[model samples]
Structures are given as structure tokens and as C-alpha cells.
Target chain A: MTKPTGPSRRTFLKTTAAATLAAPTIVSPSIFAKGDTPAPSDRVVVGSIGVGDLGRRHHLNNKLLVNPRIQVAAVCDVDRNHRDLAANDVLTKSGKMPGVYKDFRDLCDRKDIDAVFVVTPDHWHALVSIYAMETGKDVYCEKPLTLNIEEGKKMVEVARRYGAVFQTGSQQRSEGPFRQAVELIRNGKIGKVQRVDTYIGNIDAGKWQAPITPPPELDWNFWLGPAPYADYFPNRCHYQFRWFSDYSGGKMTDWGAHHNDITQWALEKDQSGPVKVRCEQAQFAPDGPHDVALEFDIAYTYADGVELHCHSQGKNGIKFTGTDGWVFVSRSQKEFDAHDKALLTWQAGDNDVNLPRTETKHPHHDNFLDCIASRQRPICDVEIGHRSATVCHLGNIAIRLGRELQWDPAKEEFVGDDQANQLVGKPMRAPWHL
Target chain B: MATVTELAGDLCSGDQVKTYQAQQALARLSGEIGASGKEAEKAEAAKALAAVLAGVKPAKDNRGEATVDSIKSVNSANELCRALSLLAGEAEVAVLAECLKNIDLRETARWCLARMTCQGAADALVEAYKTATGTEYRVGLINALGRKQGSNVLETLKLAAADKEPEVALAAVEALANTPDAALDAVISSVESGSSSRRAARVARARVRLGSTLLRAGDDAGAKKVFTAVAGADVDEAPKKAAAAAVGG
Candidate 1:
């Protein structure tokens, strides 16, 4: 594909329209008509991979399909039912039927598509996104950004090496409350942040179920791509995959991806991470299908001596306490609170540190699209997402080893701990790798 | 703090807390000895762990005759292996290699071999890969070789890349993708042009990786040439697009 010269297509079109008013013969007036569909050349063609629950409902229906700037040209899923449903949803919404495929590689291979949305399970995220980026497509992948520390590092390396536009779906970065909380903390509204507490809840282990033949529409082997081979149990696939260690890190990575991400942003540690992590307490279910930690309390110590605590109990939110006061934020009705009520209404002055703000209805997706056109980094770029996800992975590693780990943030390795380092990158099953 | 002998005994105590504490203490001692530049002490500690490993009997629950003692012995053996992963060197390679053949201890043994920086570890894995009969076991050895990438294992991987079993071939191809060696380029290129869809996907990924490797080495023209070739090839679209993107940028 040829790169657009100078201004982006959208910007050029806007400039052309402004000039057309002054010099009436430059371009056709019909091209600038409001509500007209963007020409094929101007549209950001996208392929949707892993179009399951979040892929179809949240990303496609709620965001990409409705965004006038994007065109969903293809959809892929391991389960035929999901791809077909997604194809129908696209047809119904846009009056155009997208190419549906069972394999993500086919979708990634399409030269016509400029980008892809990766909403697969955590295990599949790195491979799919890396492949998409390798094929020269920008990626908007769901969080947590990777299944392990090494995958995150590889993702960042590939993104930078390819210069691909990457947006990790840590939408909390785009939410008003989260953005406000981060801005307040950064601007010293809470003084110097000494500690942060995040509660992201927990998950119960999955009971062992007898293996059964997979459904005809579902390619169970493909669904378990990269993960270790296991017999097909219904609960092991789809939404329940989160509870299994082979597929995910359970709630530590699931809910931790959100709240901990906010904590990272508030503490201005998006690009870096804590120097040490300790699992204060942890409990796992009896040997069953699911082996992820069911309850845990993890603590992280930054190089600057700031402490961040993550727990499986208490209100589901983040609290930042500084020397002067504290600010609590969550997605609930009590979105923002502070020791001093006046801090909530305080506005940034000319000298205060200010982060990017998104006023669009779908702020995160809008930010991604905007960055795609502008060739600028999104709010949750690959590196930022990787670092935030590292926090979650480190916690899980500590709990699994039942020991505290000293982390070297720069080298992205455990300090003299080979066993802990082994968990950094797992051996992928045959045929799949980063 | 317990002496190395005391910790070694506790490691086999079969008590969960004691075994855990012993594992932690041994790891800490290994780290401290490593820091203090005491190679002899580290080797001696590793020997003690290996000795403990050999003495611990295998759990014989296959016949539904598992006893508390047998279970404890198995747990103790596993815990000793975990410690060896942190402390083992060339001195412990033989014992660890022996453990690689035991079904129960193979994982922990492979875990240790994968992390060992010693040349013996790589040699042991390559030897195991050659004689291993089980497909899954061979795949595991191939993975360890991939992590222990060097000139030593490249030939082994190239041979495995042509294995009759598709799973083994694919794993070898995936492992070879990380290695940007000129020797393996022909093999990967041939696979890219081959009939297998899964193998071809890996080759496409490898080609793109080669292009990136060229770009990183400041061979811009060479990188662009590679990108252009991949883009024009009839391979999977993802790698083609990636090549095109590299050239376009």
C-alpha cells in the first residue's frame, strides 16, 4: 500500500472544502456533502479477529461499526457460529457483508485491510496482534495486553520495529473519572503519592468436567492455539477460559488490567514498573481444571519507595494516598472522592501537567482511530500496556512461586531468580509463537 | 539459618512447610554463593541437592498403591529438582539429564536445563532430543533447545524441522523462526513454498522476522529487498502486507 503524502486524507479533504468556498472551481461540491459515506480510499479498512462476546458486542457493534471513519471489511473467529453472527451483524449495520473466516491468519493476510481488532483470549492476544502487525496492519487489542512478561516485551519490540499503530484496550485511560483521577494525582492534588491500593476482586476455580466432543461449529484445537493441549471441556473455552492458568491469569490479569492500569496512570508509571513484587497472601483451589489463584494480596515496591498494594477484597477501585490527602476512584456511583471535597471541582491551570482528554462517546476507540489517522501514539500504547500488564504478571508469578521477587524494570527480568524468570515466557504449543 | 546438610534433609522431610522452607533456603544460599563468587560452594550445594534427588524414591501410585511415604518421597524429589533449577551447573548435568527420562520429574528437569547457561545443559538436551521416542517429549526438548539457542542446537532444529510428525516439524519451524541464521534461511524459505498451511504460516513469519533483522543491522537496502520479495510472493497475506509495510515505511 502506498503511504499518503503530507496531510492525511481526512485533513486534505477538510482543507479542500475550506479552499473550495473561496475558490469555487477546485473540486466537486457533492464530495463534501454532509452524512455521505467516506470514499473507499479515505476509509480505514479494518479486520475484526476473535469476534466473540467483546469482539462482536463491544468493539464491533458499540464502537467500530458506528464509527463513520472505519470500515469493517472482515471478521474471524475459531468458532464458525461467532464469525457468522458477526458477519450478519456487520451486514445488518452497514449494508455490506464482511468476509468471514475461521482462521485469524486469513483475516490478517488480507492486503485490503489496514488494521485489526484483536479480542481473542489472553493467550492468543500476542500471536494474533504480532502477526497482524507483522502483516503491516495497525492493531487495537483488548487488555491485558499479553499473557506474560516476555510476550509483552515482544509485542512492544515488534510494534516499534514495524512502526505499527498499536492501541491496547485499557479504556480506563479514556474514561473521564479515571482520566480525572490520574490528572489530579499527577498535578499534586494529592501531594506526592506515597502509596496506592487497588481492589480487583477474585475468581473461583473451575470444577473438573468430563471431556466431550467439541461442537461442530467450534474448532477447539484452534481455540486452544498456543496454550498447552487439553481435552475439550465446555467450560475451558469461551468466557470461562479466564479462570484457567493455561489461558489466562484469572482476575489478577482480568480486573487487575483495569484498576491496576488506572493506578499505573495515576502514579505516572505507565512506561516503567515496580522494582519488587511480593505476594503477601494467596490461595488456590484444589487441583482441578482451573488452577489460577482464587484469593491474593500482592504488594509492589517502586524504586522511588512508593508502594502499590493489590487485593482480592474491599471495594472494587483504586485509592491513592499522598502526604497531604488521598483520592479514591472507581467505576461505581462513587466515581471520585477525596479527603478534601474541593479537590473534585478543581481545574488545571496553565502550568499544571495535563493529559490528553477524549470527549467522544466512545473515547478509547475514538482515540485509537484518531491516532491511526494522525500516525501518533494512542493513550495506551503498546509499551504502556505492556508495563501495566507486567504488574499483573509479576503479581501472579510471585503468588505461584510463593515468594517475593526482585524485578529489574530496565532489563525486564527477575533479579537472580531463575524459577521466577521461567514464568516470564512460557513454551507455546506446537505451531504458535510470538 | 540451617546448614546446607540440614536444609537437604528438610527438603526430604515430606512435610509441606519444611520442604517449602528448605527449597527457599537452598535458593537463597545458591544466590548468595553466586554473589560471593564462591563457585566451589555453589557446586557443593548443587551436589547435595542432586544427592537428595537420587535417594528420593519414585512414587508408585500407578498400581493404586500410593502410601503417605511414597507421596512424600515424590514431593521431596520434585522440590529438590526445583532447587536444582536455581543451583545446578555442569556438575549436576548428568543427574538432571537422568531425571529427564523419568516421566514425573521430566518437567522439572527440563525447566532446569532450559535455564542452565552451561554448555552441558545444551548438550544434554540435544542428546535427549535425538534419542527421545515420545512425540510430546521430543517437542519439549525442541522447546528447551529454542530457549537455549546457539550454534550448538541449530543443526538439531534443522533436522527436527523435517520430522514426519507435523507437530514436531511445526515446533522446530517455530523455534527456527527466532534464529535469524543464514543457514536456516533456505530451510524456512523452502517451507514457505511448501504445501502445509501451518508450516507455511510459520515460514512467512520467519521471513518477516528476517526483514526486520536486516533493518536492525542497518542494512536498509537489504531489508527493503527482502520486504519486496515477501510482498510479491504468493505466501500468506499477513507476511506480504508486513513486508509491504516495511518497504512503504
Candidate 2:
């Protein structure tokens, strides 16, 4: 695969020119017929895979469906009920029902779709997004970007090889408070940062539940996809899948993807990661369906001597402590606090470091669509997402192995640790390849 | 500090705390043995774990006859397999291969084998694949072979790719995508002649992947040839689009 050279100025200007000429305006309902299709050149047609909670409620209803320049062309899910609900929702909103698919491949095969929204489980994220990019489609995949370290590496490689505009749904990067805090830290408001503490919550140990017949509306086999086959249990699917090690890294990847992402950005390590990861403490759920860590305290050491601490028991946010002072930020607060109150009001100067900010209501989604038009990278590009997710995955690997791991961020391998390296990439169940 | 024998007993205690502690202790012991740089010590540790695993009786639940003891036995067996996975090498492959026959231990055993990074590991998987009865089980073994990728399993995978069972065949085709010396000519032929759209798509994907391997190895002309053929093949639009993008870029 060709190494990704980012979009050149020539390609960006060409795309911008085409976008300006064909950009769709917000037309009134009376002007455009109820069921008429928008000109292909004017609209970005989208197909959404995995229309469950986050897919339907957040990406579809709130972002994609409402955006005038984007059209929801289709929705796919292994759950019949979920797909029908999503299809009906699209119909009600757009006066035309989008195509419904039980398999994501069917949706990916559509040449008409300009892009795909991959909102599948973490295990399916890499394969689904890779197939989409291979088929020449931009992607907006939710975080954390991959189930294992190797998957993230492969996703970045594939994205760059295909020159796809990929966006990771670490929406916090586009939020007001996170951007402000990162900018402040980057500009030296927190002079010579020393440590960052991220407080993402813990995952509860799942209780042992006997296997039961799956709901008829769900295609259980398809739902498992690349994950290993297991007996069906209600708790093993939908929103609860995160608690299982096979599908997700529990809270480590769930909320850790968001908070730890801000920490990576604040430290300006978007492309690189810590050199050492140590699990200070960890507790696992009893032998049952769910095997992910229930609680964990992990510490990471960067080459520059900056320390990053992630805990399951603290305020659900990130606090960056530096030589000068400390600044803490969270979406829960919608505002940040600093030891020196004046730092909270500090503004960027002409020569100061300034981070990109999203001003729209649906900032993250808007940034994706804008980049798709300009042929530029999104705010949280694939490589950035992979790096942040690597931090979370490293923490999980440490807890699983119950030892400190020496990591080579450049090679993305554990130094002289064969057992640790084994956990880096899992062998997918048959029929799935990255 | 519990002795190895005491920790092994605790592994089957069916108490979550005790089991967790035992697993951790065993893992540390394995790591220590591995770090000691003594091949003899590593083999001894592997032998001890294998003995413990051999002692675990198979769980029975025919007509719901499974007891708490049976569940504990299986759980202990799996934990032992995980410990063995961390450091077991060619010396332990035979015992792990035996574990593959036990339905309860098959997945963990395969995982252990796949991580061995040894020719013996790949050979064990190939031997298992030859006689694996169920479709899912055969697929599992094939996947392990793919992860353990070598020319040794190329013929086995090529044969399995044409298996009558579509599920098993699909699994082989996907696995072949990862094999460096995979028969791309066969895959390309299947892409052109496969009647099923799904089969064609799978082969097309294999060709695209093989082309990528060639491209990465600096065989630019070979890669473009493969990509061009797939782009023009009567396969799904997804692989076609992928090939076109590769060629155009």
C-alpha cells in the first residue's frame, strides 16, 4: 500500500473550486418537490452501517438527516427492527425511504453512495471502514477507531492508500471547551506540562447469564461477524456489547476514547504515543460472559517525561497539570477551570499556537462533511484516532497481562515482550480479514 | 507467596478472587521463566501447565447434567491454556493439539497455537484442519493457520478454498488473502468464473490484497496487472472501485 502523502494544495484548491460551484443550498420545502432527488453534484449521498443507538439517535436524526447538503441514501444493520426503525425515520424526514440492508456489504456495493457512516461495534469498525474506503468512499467511523492495535494500524494504512477522507467520531475534539483547553496548553498557559489525569468511568462485571434464543428480528451470526462465536445472551448485544473483551475494551475504549483523546491532543502527541505503559491496579469481572477489566488505574510515560494517568474513579474529565498551573476540562461541565482563573480567559495571540475550532452546532459532523468537500483531513483524522485509541488499548493490554510493557511507538510493538506482542493483534474469526 | 502447586489448585477453586489471583501468579511465573533465558526452564513450565490441563475432566451437560464441579473443571482448563499460551513453544504443541479435539477447549487451544510463532504450530493447525469435522471448527483451524501464515499452509488453504461448504470455502478464501505465497492465479480464475456474486467478491478482494503485497514489495508492474484485471472483472462494484482507485492513483 502506498504511504499516505496528505492532500496537496493543488488537490485541495481543485476540490474547493468544484464544491463552491456545486454546493447545495438550504432550499425551502415548497421549492423542491417532496420526493425529488437532489442533483448528484450538489449533495453528498450517505449510507449508514449499524443503525443502533448512536447510529440512529445521534448520527442520523441529529446530524446526517438534518444536514441539507447531505442525503441519507441507505441504512444497514443486522437487527431487522433497528433497520426498519431507521428506514422509517429517514422516510418521515426526507419523504423517501432509504434502502435497508441486513448486511453492510450490500450497502457498500452501492456506487451511488458517496460516503459511509460506520457506527458498528468496535470489532467491526476496522473491516467495515476498510471495505468502505476500498470502495472509494469517505468514512465517518465512531471511536475508538479499532478493537486492537493492529487494526488501527491497518485502518490508517488503508485510509491513506485509498486517499479516503476519514473521520473518527471523537466529537469532543470539536467541542468548545476541549479546543479551548488544548489551545491554552499548547500556547504555554500551563507552562511546561508535567502530567495529565483522565477520569473515565469503570465497566461493571457482567453477570453470568445462560444462553437463550436470540430475537427473531436479529441476525445473530451477522451481528457477531468478525468476533468469535458465542451463545446468544441479551446482554451480549446492542449497547451492552462494550462490556465484553471480544467486542470492546469496556469503558477503557468507550469513554476513554473521548477523554484520553483530548489528553493526546493537549500533549500534541497525535501521531505518536507513550513509550511505557503500566497498570498500577486492575480488577476483572468473575468468570462469566463479560471478561473486560471492571476497574483499572494505568500510568503512561512519554519520551519527554510527561506522565499520563487514567483512572476509573475520578471526575469524568481530563486535568492537565503543568509547572505553571493546572487546567481541567469536561463536556459534563461545558466550561473549563484553571488554577489561575485568568488563564481560562486567555486568548490566542497572532504568534501563539491556535488549534482548529468547530463553530457549528453539530461541529464534528460538519467538520467531516467540510473536509469531504475540500479533500482535506478532518479534525480527528484516522491517524489521530488510531494513536489515541492505541493509548487506551495499551492500558488494556497491561491490565490483561498484569505487568509493565515497554512500547516502541514508532514500530507499534512491545519491546522484547513476545506475550505482549501477541495481544497486539487478534486473529479474526474466519471470513474476516483486515 | 503461593507455590506453583497451590496456585494451580486455586485456579480451579471456582472462586473469582482466587482464580484471578492464581492466573496472575501463573502469568508472572511464566514471564519469569521466559526472562530467565533458560530453554530448559521454559519447557519445564510448559510441561507443568500441560499436566494440569490434562487432569481437567471434560465438562458434561447432556440433558442438563452439568454440575458446578464440571463448570469449575472447564474454567480451570481454559485458564491453564491461557497461561500456557504466554510461553509455550514447540515442546508443548502436541498437548495443545490434543486440547483442540475438546470442544470446550478448542478456541483457547487454537489461540495458544496461533501465537506460538513456530513451524510446529502451523503444522499442528494443518493436521487439525485435515480431519476437523464441523464447519465452524474447520473454519477456526483455518483462521489459526492464516494468522500463523507460511508457505506450509498454502496448499491446505488452496484446497480448502474449493471446499463444498460455502462457509468453509469463504473462510479459506479470506485466509488465503493473508498468505504471502497464495496462488493468486487460482484466485483470479475464481474471480472470473465464480457463479456466485459473494464468491466473486471474495476472490476479487483476495486479488486486491495480493496486489497490495506485490506493490509493497516493489513489484509495481505486477501489482498494476492484478489491479487492472480485478477492475475489469465482473465482480461486485466494491472491489472494482477499489481496484480502479489503486490503478488510477
Winner by lDDT:
2
Candidate 2 lDDT over B2-85, as tens digits, reads: 866677778877666577668767765775666535668877778877777777776675625766555566577767777777
When only the first chain is scored, the TM-scores of the models are 0.92, 0.91
The CA lDDT at B158 in model 2 is 79
Q: Which stretches of candidate 2 lie over 4 Å from their true place?
A: A1-14, A17-41, A285-290, A332-335, B1-49, B52-84, B99-108, B133-136, B158-193, B228-249
Question: DockQ for model 1?
Answer: 0.17
Off by over 4 Å in 1: A1-8, A11-37, A286-289, B1-121, B128-143, B158-249
**Top TM-score: which candidate number?**
2
- Interface RMSD of predicted model 1: 6.6
Error of 1 at A371 (Å): 1.5
